[model samples]
Every structure is written in C-alpha cells, then in structure tokens.
Target chain A: MKARVFVTLKNGVLDPQGKAIANALHGLGFAGVGDVRQGKVIDIELAERDEARARATLKEMCEKLLANTVIEKYEIELQA
Target chain B: MKSAVIVFPASNCDRDAATALKQLTGQTPHMVWHRDSELPQVDLVVLPGGFSYGDYLRCGAMASQSAIMRAIKAHADRGGAVLGICNGFQVLTEAHLLPGALMRNANLQFVCRPVALEVNETQSAFTRKYEHGQRVVFPVAHGDGNYFADDETLNRLEGEGRVALRYAPGQNPNGSARDIAGILNQKRNVLGLMPHPERVVDPLLGGTDGIKLFQGLLETLS
Candidate 1:
C-alpha cells in the first residue's frame, strides 16, 4: 500500500512563501492568480497490507511527526 | 552557577552559549548531547540556536522530539530555569513548553541584524537585572522568528505580564505579534526568544547588554 499526505498551514495562518510565489508569478506576467497557499506533500510506501491499518498509521505519523497540529493540517490518502 | 547547554545535531550556538555562561558563572557549562536521556545537576539549561535536524518538517520540530527533551521538561516542571534562543525558541513551541509558533519571516527572507528590544517586564528571573522599559540591543539571526499565537493566548500573555521583551517601537524585524521578542512561561522559569543574547554578552563583541540576562538568573538562584 502507498499513502500520500499533504501538510498545509491552517487557515488564517500567514503564508509568506506562498505570497512571494504569487508576486513572482505576477512579475512574470501571469495575472489573475488568486491567493496562493503553500503546502508540502509526503509520499509514503508502506508495507502494511491492510487498508485500514495503513490509514491508521498515516494518521499516527501526521499527529506524531509529519504535521504540527498547532499550525498545520494534514490529509491522508491511501492507495492499494 | 552550574549550567548545561543542550547540543542537538547542527546546533551551532551551543559553544557561544557555553562561553557566555562560563563567563558569568566561572564554570564551563556542561555540553549535553540531544540523545542523552539524563541531564547533569545544573542551575540553568539552555537550548541554543542552530538548524537542528536541518530544520526539517518545521524548525525545531524534530529536535523537540529528541530523547533529551523529556529530561528538560522534567527540569522545567520542577521550576528550574530554562532558556531557548532562536531555533531553541521554535523547539520550545513545538514541544508545547511555550505558547505560539514561529512562522517564516513576513518578508520571506532570513533576517540577521542587530535589533533593539524593550524590556517589557523585569519581574521574571530572566529579566530582573534590567529595568522595565529599558532598551537593549541584541542580534537576531533566523529565517523563522515571526511569533504567532491565537488572540486569546496573546491577551492572556499580555494580561499576565508573561511577555518579557518586545522589539522597540517601529523596530519589529520579524512581524512577531505585538512585537514580542521574548516570553516567559506561566512559572516564569522558562524563556524563549529569537535574539541571540549569548552572542552579545561580551563588551568586545560590541555590547554587553546581554550579560545581565545570565547574571540575573545567577542572582535569582543564589
């Protein structure tokens, strides 16, 4: 099984990197871009055969290490 | 006074912290590695600045989970003095020892410069040597030093006088909330700040305003 996790700053949190990226895009003549928020994706290859077990492990990973619940939110997707 | 400087992988400021403490106390601080589960008997524990664990995941996130933090927490629970500088501040937040998180600089650049700070409250062990509202200069060097906390927490901190220091008016270098440069925990035994006071303790280093911080701790403990 494989799992993908997306970690992003919580809503209302400032995203300076995203704002800089948006400014650079506009400077390159790419207009009409709305607010851009930056996030990170972590791809995990798991040996766990059970779908439920994989998801549970991913959640644990996010809570314990991958994401800081105080400022980040994480979503997990499991693929078999 | 006995002191210990926790050294995480890539902790570049441990030496400076050790030097500053030695200068103040006449004893070299114990250089404790992050993986050590035990701490030496000491009066102060310092988490120095550096790109710990390469600042992966988030600044200080991985470092906060190291084996040594448990001991540090135990020390803090006993009302022992603990100070976190720069990356150490981030670790304290990640470890939930302090309120709020340090976000990237508002300008998205690593800011390194001498910044003027105001002593917000001198009642704590960390700032007792300085008069309230006095201005001091310390060099801040970091990419993620902008402190953020929920409104309620900010209000509580302000009301309780837990805010130990603030950037001088119009001198906020990292957009920290209310221009906070340093804060104390509820017990006032733990302090976290972005500026490198350890780097500014010697007069030959351009200023010795930071010396009082460590000296104040020794005075309080004695």
Candidate 2:
C-alpha cells in the first residue's frame, strides 16, 4: 500500500515562497494569476495491507510530524 | 550556576552558548547530545541556534522530536530555566513549549544584522538585569524569523505580559507580530528568542548588551 500527504500552509498564514513564485510568474508575462500558494506532497510506502489502517497511520504521522497544524493543513490519500 | 547546552546534530551555536555560559558563570556547561535521554543536574538548559536536521520538513521539526526533548520538557515542567535562540526558538514552538510559529521573512530574505530591541518584561528570570523599555542591540540572523500567532493568542500574550522583548520602534526585521523578539512561557521559566545573544557576549564582538541577559540569569538562578 502507499499513501500520499499534501501539506499546505493555512489560508491566513503568509507564504513567502508562494509569493516569490507568483512574482516570478508575473515577470514571465503570465498575467491573470491572481494568487498562488505553494505546497508539498509527500509519498510514503507502507507495508500494511489494510487501506483503513494505512490511512489511520498516515493521519497520525501528519498530526505528529508531517503537518505542524499550527500553520499547516494536510490531506491524506491512500492507495492499495 | 550549572548549565547544559543541548547539541543537535546540525547545531552550530552550541559552542558559542557554552562559551558565553562559562565566561559568565565560571563553569563550562555540559554539552548534552540530542540522543541523550538523561540530563545532568543543572540550573539552566539552552537550545542553541543552528540548522538542526538541516532544517528539513520545517525548521526544528525533526529536532523537536529527538530523545532529549522529553528530558528538556521535564526540566521545563519543573520550573527549570530554558533558553532557546534562533533555530532553538523554532524548536520550542514546534515542541509546543511556546506559542506561535516562525515563518519566513516577509521579504523572503535571510536577514542578518544588529537590531535594537526593547525590553518589555524585566521581572522574568531572564530579563531582570535590564529595566523595562530599555533598548539593546543584538544581532539577528535567520531566514525564518517572522513570528505568527492568532489574534487571540497574541492578545493573551500581551495581556499576560509574556512578551519579553520586541524590536525597537520601526526596527521590525522579520515582520514578527507586535515586533516580538522574544517571549516567555506561562511559567516564565522558558524563553525563546530569535536574536543570537550568545554571539554578542564579548566586547570584541562589538557589543556586550547580550551579556546582561546571561548575567541576569546567573543572578536569579544562583
């Protein structure tokens, strides 16, 4: 089984990298891009055969280490 | 006073912290590794600045979960004094020992320079030597020094006088809320700040304002 986690800064949190990327896009003449927020995706391979169990484990990982929760939000996707 | 400086793998400021502690207290601090679960008897514990775990996953995230953090938490729980500088400050917040998180500078630049700081709370064990509202200069070097917290938390911190230091008026280097440069925990035993006071302890280093911080700690802890 495999799991993927998408971590993103919360809506109100300032994202400097995202801002920089947005500016760069503007410089390249890509107009009409109102806002850009950058995030990361982490892929993990699990030995657990149960999709439910893998998702549960991934959630724990997100809460404990993957996502800070204070400034970040995470989504978990499990594949069998 | 006895002190210990926790050394995470990528910690670069441990030596400077140890030097500052030894120079002020006349005793070399114990250099405890991150893997150590036990701490020697000490009056203070310092988490020095550095790119711990290469600042991977987030600054201080991995290091906060190290074996030694449990011991550090235990010490802080017992009203033991703990000081965290720069990345150390990030670790404290990540560990939930302090409030708020440090974000990248608003300008997305690595800021490193001497900035004036105003002492907001002199009653804490760490700032007793300075008078409230005193302005001191300390060098801050960090890429992620912007401090962020919700409005309620910020209000609570201000109302409770937990804010220990703030950048002098119009000198906010990293867009920290209320220009906060340092803060104390609810117990006032733990302090986390972004400036590198340890690097400014010697007169030859161009400033000694930072020495008063260590001296204050020694006076209260001893």
After TM-score superposition, the amount by which residue A18's alpha carbon in candidate 1 deviates from its true location, in angstroms, is 0.7
Q: Candidate 2, A32: how far from true, in Å?
A: 1.4
Worst 10 residues of 2 chain B by lDDT: B196-205
| Root-mean-square deviation per candidate | 1.1, 0.8
lDDT of 2 by residue, B47-143 (tens): 9999999999999999999999999999999999999999999999999999999988998899999999999998798999999999999999999
Under CAPRI classification, how is model 2 graded? high
**TM value for model 1:** 0.97
Please, what are the lDDT tens digits per residue for candidate 2 over residues A4-77?
89999999898889989999999999989878999999999999998888888889999999999989999998
Which candidate wins on DockQ? Answer: 2
How well docked is model 2, in DockQ terms?
0.87
> What is model 1's DockQ versus the real complex?
0.80
> What's the lDDT for residue B182 in model 1?
94
- The most accurate candidate by TM-score is 2
lDDT to native, each model = 0.93, 0.94
Runs with alpha carbons beyond 4 Å of true place in candidate 2: none
